[model samples]
Target: MISMFVTDLDGTLLKNNRYITKEDKEALQLLNKKGVDITIATGRSDREVQAVFKELNITGHRISQNGTFTFSKYNENVFSQVFEEGTSLKLFDFLHAFDFPCLISNFDNIHYAKEIPMAQTLQSLFKTPLIYQQDLRNRIEQDFSTSKFMLLGETSELLSLEKKIISLFDTDVSTFLSADMCLDIVPKGADKRRALEALLNQTGIKKQATASIGDGFNDINMLAYTPHSYVMSSAEPKVKLHGKKTVQHVYEAVDDLFCHNLIL
Candidate 1:
């Protein structure tokens, strides 16, 4: 009865190298043949997500920026949630207290506080322009309107910063740890679940017909909301606990869920 397959990109769908495995590709093809809608929900930007789709030959609606934006593979915008101008400025001021690097994602570009090692690493991985700026506040105000903000640093530092930001903002913004060293911020209540709801509303798909797969903490809300939820076997314990079932990998689940029945 599952009509939609919602997957997280990093560590869930894509391998560590950021490429879809042949097994995953075959699984998706099988799902398509069975009339299932395969979609993606991730913390990446539209540009990054599009690149992934092109590499995988996937055509589906994508929920990006941890649900701040939703668009289709055909480059159509379906939904978006942007931070208020004042909120953006407040966050920028607060982040200035920390020395760790950060990136601000607008509709089309990524702006950095300063050139950092992590920025360079991500540039090599994503192949997107990384604009270095001395004054992020001015740069954000002038060049682009931010949809989401991300911070990269050690886990302890990021956690400490997350606590402080939440205490100060007091629910003014939503915060999530996508990885051990990564913190993603969006407007309060703007999460993957909210984005899933919006997508369901737009496509007239019921909750019972949806399935979500993920491998991280940021994906918990969306997994909880879906009726048929799955977590990767390689996911952290907390993430694994949220799903009704766990699979060894994206392809294993896809193969079992869609292909095994074909020969019978």
Candidate 2:
């Protein structure tokens, strides 16, 4: 019996407008009332998850920062991972070479270079304030460490950048395309699947009892880890292939899953 529902936020749970529909909310509420654990696993930050919960009026654990951090709705930190300072510095140099706008994110805060135009764009998308610093390398070296770094730009450019970073960093870094225009870099093996595994261990939930839903490439790993997994109908072809089922919308998927007794 599936007793846990782990969903991604952007395109799986949130509509195109980035808000949870009434149907989606009701479905989650119903699952919650049934004692099913409903959680969000996304490439977003803890702050972003909190904002999403507030807007949707949903309470559950969260896997954030592309699985580098896991915490509950009450802001308790359950598990976290950080990138090494030297490795992060090397990565910063590589990203600087590409001239792509980037965000240096830790489990606690998101820091940005002063000159990155895309920083404001991402801030607007996340509806969160940006923490700007002049010397990004020094800032990363001194004040913060990261579980992940997120880059925003066109797909082609980001992909090329990713290849270059991989060649340079080798096995020490793991790279993935979270969105068409978003590239995420983390320590090797730090991903949503690992995050979910950690969450399951901490909560004493069986892997087969969890259902994961997502709509983007970064979500693929988590989707594959759960027994019952769903991909949004609108997801890219590659992402859709990873899920056992696909739905046109979040509520429809949840409704079908429950009504058909697909999950216990």
Q: Whose TM-score is greatest here? A: 2
Show where candidate 1 strays beyond 4 Å: 73-76, 259-264
Per-candidate TM-scores read: 0.92, 0.93
- Score candidate 2 by TM-score against the native: 0.93
Per-residue lDDT over 122-182 for candidate 2, one digit per residue giving the tens place of the 0 to 100 score: 6666746778877868877785776788887889988887887888887788888876688
CA lDDT of every candidate: 0.80, 0.80
Model 1, 83: alpha-carbon shift in Å?
0.7
Q: Which residue pairs come into collision in candidate 1? A: none
